[model samples]
Target: MQNNKRRLVRHELNASIDVWDAQSDEHLGRLANIHAQGLMLLSDAPLVEERLYSLRLTLPQSLVGAGELTLAVDCLWVKSSEDESRHWAGCHIIDISDQGLAVVELLISRLR
Candidate 1:
């Protein structure tokens, strides 16, 4: 059963885009889907629920005119994939700059 409680629709990317931990610069995971208010990540490990994270999204320069965007996000939930080889995390964007938001909007539009 799938939960359909999200307010904003998320767009899945065809290309690979990596998400990283901004402070540690560690490669956290790949962006599974994204929207203006939130994003989902596919990682090797599960993220702690209800914890805040500073993440860096690396985007193609041609798509956003910039290389990366930093965001503060709160992990809402996490679940292990059925195969148990990966984890999916749902996170809500808590903070972002106006420019970063613009880039996100643009990316969503292009994805659509």
Candidate 2:
């Protein structure tokens, strides 16, 4: 059965990100709200839907202690916001380390 409930709480963070195409290394854009499962990304250039990208997101030192959270994410969907200055992409977290997950949890807890 497909689980409909949210597995993790999403924390809203208009945080900057270093995103790039996993294969080509072309820069993508910054990250928006993030959760353990997925995230919203804002990009000047539209990202191809249904592609995996590598991301280096640095949480505020107060939130994550220090260092960047690196992970591979699958782009699920994309749409241009009303203003059309940026495209919002939905992404799913494909892989992350245990330590990364721990830092994310701490960030979420603090947000709550």
Candidate 3:
């Protein structure tokens, strides 16, 4: 069996939080789950693995008193669903502001 090397536990998000391309403002996907280090995105198209992406997450105003959070992420992997209707991409958080990290932590807490 392959050992899991992940140090952080991922939390599946209940709400539909849209993920966007920060540069182009294109809709990339919805956040499926998140952790302190990374997140999983459910998208209509597969993201290129090993590529770095600037993502913007639209957070609920009531949750963190913020409209959006931007993050620099490195795409780790991408997989298609069984029915091939959607794609899921795993990404590593490469860069984020202190405030962004704080918001992410708060979001994880609220998820639990």
Candidate 4:
């Protein structure tokens, strides 16, 4: 088995938060799922390969509030062969602030 993340864990729907387009930036789609290292987002928009982008994962229901948590990430890969017309962007968080890490951990814990 290969572990690409420092501590990867799957988060259930209860723990999952909705991420949005901070700048109304054009993205392929909304975030579908997240792990310790990164997340997968589905979008109908087109994106350049291997581009780095900033995203804000909103914690509207959580104690973290509806604030924006900035994440610097690069596209690890993209899948467009699915039956759905939308494409999926597989990303890697290049940098995550301490707060971001805590939030991710909390989300993971909720899954357990």
| Cα-based lDDT for every prediction | 0.91, 0.74, 0.92, 0.67
Clashing pairs in 4: 28-43, 28-44, 29-42, 29-43
Residue 5 lDDT, candidate 4, scale 0-100: 57
TM-score of each: 0.93, 0.74, 0.94, 0.71
lDDT of 3 at 106: 88
Best model number under lDDT: 3
Question: What tens digits encode model 2's per-residue C-alpha lDDT throughout 1-112?
Answer: 7454667666775445555665566667776767888877878988778887787765676665576677888888898978888898888889989897786677566754
Off by over 4 Å in 2: 1-9, 14-27
* Per-residue lDDT of 92 in model 2: 88
Error of 3 at 86 (Å): 0.6
Model 3 TM-score is 0.94
Task: Give the clash count for each candidate.
Answer: 0, 0, 0, 4
Off by over 4 Å in 1: none
Error of 4 at 97 (Å): 0.5
Model 3 off-target regions past 4 Å? Answer: 1-3
- Which ten-residue region of model 4 has the weakest summed lDDT? 9-18
Predict model 4's lDDT versus the native.
0.67
For residue 110, what is the lDDT in candidate 3? 82
lDDT per residue, candidate 4, 1-112, as tens digits? Answer: 6455536654444544555555665333565777778877767764456988777776646456646577878887776755757777778888888888887776666643
Per-residue lDDT of 21-62 in model 3, one digit per residue for the tens?
999899999999998799999999899999999999999888
**The 10-residue segment with the lowest total lDDT in model 2:** 13-22
Q: How far out, in Å, is residue 5 in model 3? A: 2.3
